[model samples]
Target: MAASFTTSWRCAFLALLALFVSGAYGQLSPTFYASTCPNLTTIVRDAMVTALNPAVGGERRMGASLLRLHFHDCFVEGCDGSVLLDNVPANGSTPAFFGEKNAFGNINSVRGFEVIDTIKAAVEQACPGVVSCADILTLAARDGTFLLGGPTWAVPLGRRDSTTASMDLANRDLPPPFANLVTNPPDGSDLIARFQRKGLSATEMTVLSGAHTIGSAQCQNYRLRLYNENRIDFQFAQGLKANCPQNGPAGDTFLAPLDSTGSTFDNKYYTDLTGLRGLLHSDQVLYPQNNQTQAKIVLKYKGDNTAFFADFAAAMIKMGNLSPLTGTAGQIRTNCRLVNPA
Candidate 1:
């Protein structure tokens, strides 16, 4: 009788665990829209191609912007599309609410919303309220990365959009460019902690930082590193200083490529870190001589492009799966920018 009871208890425990795991991630499927919205990938890819075409009022850098938008969205509210909400003014009973767009790390920084709007419009034309903005953002990021020569991964779908947005959560959860720079030697503990809080490991944090390989940073984002930090390459600093002055807002908006090959997705980000040419203080801190583990991973990626691509794709998929709202939860917004009207 005792043995039978123990077996029954163990089986019940395992069954509950399986149910919880399925509820979290099993609902998402790669072919989720195969029957409902078959042309979803093509639509997103076409829009992305148009957006990345510089000849038609678009920019190649928009690929990086779109990818960054997805990253920012996922970090704040588990990839529920809250970051896309626009600020709403008080209308009688409805109180004023600021959104993630104007958050400290996002204001004037995250772009490609117009592109997302364009994609959302196209998707709506075909599927008509069947898809979620969260899924669109996820697919757009994957498409953008692949179009820009990065590894492509299978993005699980069926995510729902959040009707609400949170500026405070965005400001609090999104790691800033200077997060790892607060320490004397800049050990990267703070930045690691930030990613860890989001359920990412330190190695995953290092891998995701490789996304910096293709983006550009505003002068204001790296001004202190160019002028004050000793870890940066001297020539790199001098080159940047020509555009970013040491003491003013005048050159704040000036732009600098994050890596030598800024427009192409590759392992050059890790290579730059190996040479102390990483543009951001948070970036360079990953490969500091003191942090053997992170430095080793950086060096490994620097030499092995194949490994970098594989790990990056895996990390992206994991990040996309963060606390998604599926089943009947949340709503599919008609516009990526605003929640549907009640």
Candidate 2:
């Protein structure tokens, strides 16, 4: 009798563990919309191709912006499309509220909204309220990167959109380019911690940072590093100083390539860090002056593009899996910019 009771208890425990894991992490699928919206991938790709416009340097600019939007959307309150909300100005118009658009990490930084809107409209024409805005954003990021000559990955879908947006959480959770780490010389442990909380590892954090390889940074974002930091490359710093003056002559609108090959997706960003040519302070922190962990990861990617591409695609899937709202938990918004009205 005692042996039978112990066997029953063990089986019950394992069953419960399986249920928890499956319900929590196994909710998304690569073919989630196969029957519901059969043309979802093709639709998103066509929309992205038009919006990205590779013929005129548009793909280079929009690819990074779309990726940034997806990251911003996922990190705050899951990948439920909350980061796309727009609130009314607090000028006695309607009930006043702040949207994630004006959040600290976002504000004038995150773009590709018009492109997302265009994609959403095209998706709606095909499937009409069947596909969710959250899924569209995820697919857009993947397709945008693919069109720009980067590694392609299957984006798991079936995420729902959040009716509410959170500016406060966005400001608090999203890692900035100037966050301090837990180490003496800033080895990027803080950034790692933030990603870790969302189920990402330090190695994955380094892989995602490679997105910087194809984007342009505004003068405002890197001016602090150019003026104050001593670890940046000397000639690179001098060239930046010429465009972005010490005071207010150029202000903050000037643009600088994030990597040597800003228009193409490659391992050059990692090589840039190896030479102390990293643009953002948070970026430089990964391979700090005297670092061990992140520095070695940088060198590995700098040496091998195939390894970098594989790891980056895997990391993106992991990042996309963070805290999704599925199974009737959230609404499918008609317009990504506003919550659907009752």
Candidate 3:
């Protein structure tokens, strides 16, 4: 018995060919944290950096390294955008600066919404209504946390943005770089103080300093802590004599290669912090005393960089969601820059 060629077989073959071609041109839906959600992981991640860049004093905060600062601060609870939004009224100094201990202000920190706006503007051109601005903030923050040696826990997509920056709430939400600020006793925990508040121990703080492995900083941002000659506890080594001035009102480019791998992200920031070469005093404070645990973490990383990086990732996951407004409480920005967009 012989089999005959049938029209049905030909039709089936043609259909198979068509399916293959379609799949080749158009991929299957992306895999988001949620099954029904399409893959917007990349969209959210890229959008976050874009939004984060312009917020840190524009050109000043564009570096990938500093974004970790945003991640570390926010991840203590949720992505509250408190670190970025200081325009709203606060109990003391609404505009807080990261490097300026004397005049602490949060002026240039970029919020998730800003990143959402820029990313949306770009993603809109690519895929309209396929992604959410809220997710981008979280993804970028998580990725940032990861880069800074923090955990990379998965966050769900479809998060909404807030309509307003919470100044009253912001102060409560975000920890200042220097707490208990005073001339004597250096009362507050520097960066370690805030890190502790976020549930990370001193060891985590020391290891997290590895984030400075590849970022740029405002000379003024690190100057007070690095070029200290005024008996401010934060003092610079004589090796930095040529770059930073021994006077006031400094400029950028005062320091170079803060870590051995200043161009790449790694645990070198921890090593530098141990040597008192940390750019920010907050970074240096995680050593020898109240932050003994953090100091141990740094020493451990000094011997084993891998362990430091691992701890950093865990801490980052914890940091990104610190006091974040999710579910229904916050507004999802169509554009991250202008509030609600006119």
* Top TM-score hit: 1
Expressed as tens digits, the lDDT of each residue in 1-342 for candidate 3 is 122344344335444543443233232111333444344566656544444444653432234433543553354335543333223323365553232111234444332334445656666666654444545554665565544344344443443445544444345534444332122455344454455666766555555556667655555555566555332233445545456665745544454555556555566676676666765555555554564554576678877755555555544434444455545566645454334534
Provide C-alpha RMSD values for all models, in order.
8.5, 8.8, 13.3
| Runs of candidate 3 exceeding 4 Å displacement | 1-37, 44-66, 72-77, 82-105, 108-117, 125-134, 141-158, 167-193, 229-236, 250-258, 289-292
Q: TM-score: which is higher, 1 or 2?
A: 1
Q: Write the per-residue lDDT of candidate 2 for residues 1-342, one digit (tens) a residue.
A: 996886565445444543443355667777788898999899998888877786854555798889889999999988888888887666665677788988989998899988889889988999899888888999998887777788777677788999888898888789888864345564544787788778888889899989888888888888889999988999989988988887754668788999999878899999998888888888888886566876899989999887787778777777787888888788999999987888
Tens digits of per-residue lDDT, candidate 1, 62-180, equal: 98998999999999879899889898889999898899998999999999888889899999999999989999999989888988999777677889999888888888888888877
> Top model by lDDT, which number?
1
- Estimate the TM-score for candidate 2: 0.88
lDDT accuracy of residue 235 in candidate 3:
41
TM-score, candidate 3, is: 0.64
lDDT of 3 at 113: 38
Comparing candidate 1 with candidate 2, which one achieves the higher lDDT? 1
